[model samples]
Target: MDKPVLPLTYEQIDHWIASLQPELAREGFTHAVGILRGGAWPATLVSHATGAVPAFLRYERATRTAVWDSSVPLPARGSKVLVCEDIAGAGHTLADCVSFLREQGLVVKTLTVVFDDLSRMRPDYGMDCRGYFALLPWERHAYTDRYRARWQHTQAGTLGPIGEDHEFAVYAIDLDGVLLPDVPPHRYDADLMAALEERDALLPFEHLPQIDFSRTQAIVTGRPEIDRARTADWLARHGYAHLRLVMRDPSRHGEHPEQVAAYKAEAALELACTHFIESDPVQAIFIAQHAPLLRVVWWDAARRAAKLIATQAWRGADAPTP
Candidate 1:
């Protein structure tokens, strides 16, 4: 049986942070270092509570080393530093971070919300974890991106090869916000390109409960064709493989944002799937307007909620006149 996913709320995080007050009440800590993206929020919370200066320790995947960003100077000699992470699953990240801090000649302490039983490295403080995957409030974007099953009887299985007359419900899904959290558009710069090239970022989003990959007919995404390799790797790692993925052909349409909507609408119309789950509200609305016969379900990443947008069964008479 698949393990049930436990979604942790902000209130739960606040409670856990409160529980660690007794352990962190000591007076010697000079700085609180966050382990980049995942650790930033909790570290900030700890810093706010304890009055410690906040800093970042970024992990370089290519080098497999954790180093301070140099923007923030290391603490004074013999100063105590508290490190925070959202979880200590597999123990690799925190372990590497602690080793890096120790090498810098600073006293180090670790804090994590969830501690996996199988992790080789134990944290200085952690809450008891009870699920295969713990979705932190900060990671809620992922939970919202997953396809929630409305048809429970649909068994999980792979979509057979295309061009065959397969008699199964096909769901056309948007990639970024629907199946995985989309990277913030503002961060599309040289740094983002570097991260992609390093293969250290763009990790796969965890699927929510009731999501069966076999139900996916085709993934129509706005991501450029250049990202095909990394996107494929991420999908395969997350158990989505051998399915038709339609990405924007930048060579033909260029990177005009408007072209993305047109491409997606074209794919949805061509597939004529039973449903299309989309993350972008505007795109979802566009799909509903263009493909009135197709049901559109909206996955709100910000609110972590799902809503049925539009649905109209198509008849042969309703075919578009070209």
Candidate 2:
């Protein structure tokens, strides 16, 4: 069999991830292992998806044709491991990793990649995102430009989808208000992230139960690890109880802020996401160059709850933008 040509920028990876979360959570695993660097980020994402904390596996193959060669290997204990890589091309490295683990007497429950390239081989778990190979050229563009005053929404599996170029289920959401809260809300700067924690504090387990955290394969953001860590931690602490993942923003994903929403949206749409949430009312044109993401304006939980209290989902779509 021949290996498919998928790029590292494919968007379907998110879709694959979103679709895979529920399965991962339903069949809970013990520990998650990351491939390092690229794999680390995906591990964080998977962690967020599965709500499981992951450990790093220090291994460097140096070449695709060679066997596993690294100073660090999996632990000696027999753990239900979910090994991850940033993007996969066939199952060469993963196969080697599995073999190595087996040799040491370990159990690997699942082998997944943020991006899976099935041109030739396949991993036990992951989305089949193939568009990455075709859009490699533009896949690079996802980070090149900004909003540019035009509304662009990615479907979550195409911009620069990485992996074997397969299809998987996905959840699409307009970030900003949904994940990061579009604006700070007040002069004090909403500390949007702080608000996230605040909101989580109010809820029994944050607001995780309110939304489908298990289906969240990815949460696109322009924020750096430092800014995202606080809120991400909160999610991990309460929302994502235990699902292995690496939830750090990649330099590439965060490069273009203006276009970030659209790029992410585009990928989300492709995966036929379950839902989307966003708000640009608080931002200037410079911030939300492309406004009016969806039909219903975004509102805070208080307002949203108020609307439901007074009426029903029949009036849910037209909620206020405050």
Candidate 3:
């Protein structure tokens, strides 16, 4: 059994911060000390909201050392300070930082965006996000295998493998019809080189799907890997350079719809994506059939609507006409 992930958006964070403002403003905090990196976002926002002098402390997880950032002047002894962190999990960072601040004779009240039941130190203020693996938008790259390997190297002895322990909202999308117009097959049949040139020239659709590209983990395309250069160029030109592009193998080029769907299903599984958005209804259905647990959405470009495929049963006859 895996812990379900709660994908958090910036809007949700903003809302959480907003909800904290009135209470934080009432606290009359003199200084805001943000834990470096993740904590900085909330701490800076809290400072702006409460008029607290901002400071930071960088904590080295491996060394269990907390060092105040010398660039920002430390809060005066006896001054009331509000310490902020992104999360207070089963980690010592928050506890240690609070202790360090208290030892300096500063009055400290802890704050965090989220804290679980197993947290080492419960903050005075934070949302109770127990049970779920709270995935933040800023740390989206943590879903990668490399990051997991790093985590295993550093903390796996205590925390276990992140993938097996937690479910994540990794998303995959189709490239051609979803991001841009699909180059008509007839165009390619007529003139392969000219069609490739036309595809390379085609701009992203004027009205694209309502997907948050920030959360889109990969672009799975039926286009052969031979078009990698042009596909990459188009993606980069359209401000999606950061996304991973998975193309059909050159050996499997010109595969039929069933083969293409198989390739997509395999890619989705390989990537461990939880959801997939596809442009073709048939492909979407096939993907859902192959990966029953995955949430597949069919994007109807012409209708400007997205339909969720709830059942794995094939309903090609019911599929909307292109």
> Each candidate: how many clashes?
1, 68, 0
Tell me how far the alpha carbon of residue 267 in candidate 2 is from the true structure, in angstroms, after superposition.
Answer: 20
- lDDT by residue (1-322, candidate 2, tens digit) is 1333333333355656777788888766555666654466566667788866676655544443323233444455675667776546544666666666666666775455533445344666755566543222222222212321111332232343233211222333334455433335462264765765564444231232144545554554444456655646655765543433233255644545445544544443333332333343322222222322211223354344311111012236678755
Q: Per-prediction TM-score, please?
A: 0.46, 0.37, 0.56
Model 1 per-residue lDDT tens digits across residues 242-291: 77888888776555554666677677655546567888877777666555
Candidate 3 per-residue lDDT, tens place, 79-170, comes to: 88998898896889998898898999889999888887678888998888898766675665464555666576757566544453224466
Each candidate: RMSD: 20.3, 18.8, 12.2
Ranking by TM-score: 3, 1, 2
**What's the residue-level lDDT of 224 in candidate 3?**
87
Model 3: residues with Cα > 4 Å off, grouped in runs? 156-181, 184-322
Name the lDDT value of residue 45 in candidate 3.
84
lDDT per model, in order?
A: 0.69, 0.46, 0.81
Candidate no. 1 TM-score: 0.46
